[model samples]
Target: MPAWSSEMGAAMQVQIDKIFKEAAMQENIDDDAVFQEGDGVLAHLKFSFTLSDPGLKDCPLIGCSDGFSELTGYTMEEIIGRNCRFLVDPVPQEHVENSARMVAREFCIAVKDGEMYTVPDAHREPWMPIVHRDDGIFCIQTNARKDACLFKNLFHLKKIELDEKVYIVGLQTEMPIELWDEDQPEEKRQDACRAACRACHKNMGAAEQVMAKHFWFSSPMRRQEDGNDEDDGFV
Candidate 1:
């Protein structure tokens, strides 16, 4: 996974806004028309914000579609204002440290009547294995009690294979800085910090490689000749 470039992120946001605006227009036509039962179009969940707010500590779920309730066990009342990330268990600190340290958020969408709709919540339980489709693509259903209605809906809308594996990979939100204790010797603490910084840089580079290979995006990780950039590399 690789971090999205500023231009790419802005482009995506524009597209997403168009989708939501169309959905809103449709809603105005008929309140009961959006998520009819058995429509086979997975309902979309709409939040107040189109993009994630980096400054906020947590992203709250302000509103969701009726289809969201149908897929998840909880209704809008239970889910609204809660962090959507809660659907899946937290990633362990050790796992984050050992892996590429990138978080890949998944979103499923469908186009109906020339309007694009997206599912609000799509996450698999931490315990379940990633499911593979006949086409060799991997998928993880939302940890909801109901079946994968959203996925099924998306498949129905577009007969093409879905690439759930495509991820907006970026640095892990929280780093394991606490792994070093203050009581440790100054030299030992400094060494540990250096090691952690190196690991972060390595993970970031790996993520960039994946993005470049798969999406044809240029690498965002630039090597510094001075080597002082290591101090600012703790992601």
Candidate 2:
């Protein structure tokens, strides 16, 4: 039996519904679903429209599940009612602006621009996307190295300064390890040449791994001068 009364369930569902419904209607969405369990409920929303401008005022519904706020150094409130472009530097405003125009036409573009990029594992090849929105915007997304449209597999190591600290980010190849069954003896299968599987592993140590691969965020090195970096006290 469920712990909460039907009345409570209805009210919670209402809260969830209102939020998503409001989001979809005001922003770039048409329909959404709300689920209820116990005292809390969850909402999975999808916007039907392409957002040329992803601002907080347009999308107020959010969650702190992954501590993205701390990672990007911005509170949820600040992120809300503002464009995600805040993640980009003011100098790159032109690039973001042009990308927005592309989305309006619904054309997928993967240009090797040195600005917007992502590195999901914070290593390997960054995934950059030519964004085409239903509402008509063309944006690129990447999850690999830096603004360079290159990967660790092909490009040499690069140096980046963050919060006054100078660090080198590069590609290093390491063997992949897989767990094997100890209870059963190893057998030579038709497609198996070796018992252990070796593949590529993307690893980041300490400071290099602090930033995420794909999404954009403000870095201390974006503005701080080299000699004056020590005074900033950023990690």
Candidate 3:
């Protein structure tokens, strides 16, 4: 399995989380999603059920977890309405050719075969296999549970990477200003409101009011030296 630095993992986790949230909201709520969590990471799958009882096309994508996007490097916007083969590499080695075929046909095949399944930009690895049911609509239940000993467990590490990626999304997104907790006592609370107001007063009057929004209520960097001195005893 490939190892990523803690920083990369942290950064990726944040984006993955948002991806999962969007998946959840889209799939089960209003057919806006493409996949959902049936179980733990491996058990998660993309399900399609037709609305008009004709074919897979009638089935609207509802939701998919962040793992889906992480493995494919495509957001939900690009994935929905696309064939599953979008993730597979068009040209593959002999070993992976069969696996790709099995996935393309939507058949239940084992991943232990020498063939590799391309996961878009992520990797050209074996397709993780499970019992695939294509009788009515496309559905796959991954069989390689953590307990199962497969030759190359690609999904395991991939799932972990996706999970870590989702966790990193927290750093990238922000909440509404009013949503912040207001219960902190004065001594413990930093005066962001005061800082913001002061900024608005100062910058709003400047000739370049166009840049005012960028500087409003921005946080000041805390010096490392100040932190060190605060931790040290009086000399």
Evaluate all candidate structures by whole-model CA lDDT and list the values in order. 0.30, 0.25, 0.26
Which residue runs of candidate 1 sit more than 4 Å off their true CA positions? 1-55, 90-102, 105-142, 146-235
Tell me the tens digit of each residue's lDDT in model 1 across 5-54.
43443333333334344544444323233233244111333211112222
User: What TM-score goes with each of the models?
Assistant: 0.24, 0.21, 0.24
Model 3: residues >4 Å from true position, as ranges? 1-54, 58-62, 91-95, 103-235
How many backbone clashes does every candidate have?
A: 0, 25, 29
TM-score of 3: 0.24
Off by over 4 Å in 2: 1-57, 89-91, 94-97, 100-235
- The clash number for model 2 is 25
In candidate 1, position 140 carries an lDDT of: 25
Better of 2 and 3 by TM-score: 3
Candidate 3's residue-wise lDDT over 1-235, tens digit each? 1222333333333334433444454544222121224522212422111001012342222233334444444565554544443433332343244543454342211112222333332222322222122111111112111223211112211100121121100011111123134764442212322221222222211211111111111212121112333311111
Please give the distance, in angstroms, between residue 186's alpha carbon in candidate 3 and its true position after superposition. Answer: 63
Return whichever of 1 and 2 wins on TM-score.
Answer: 1
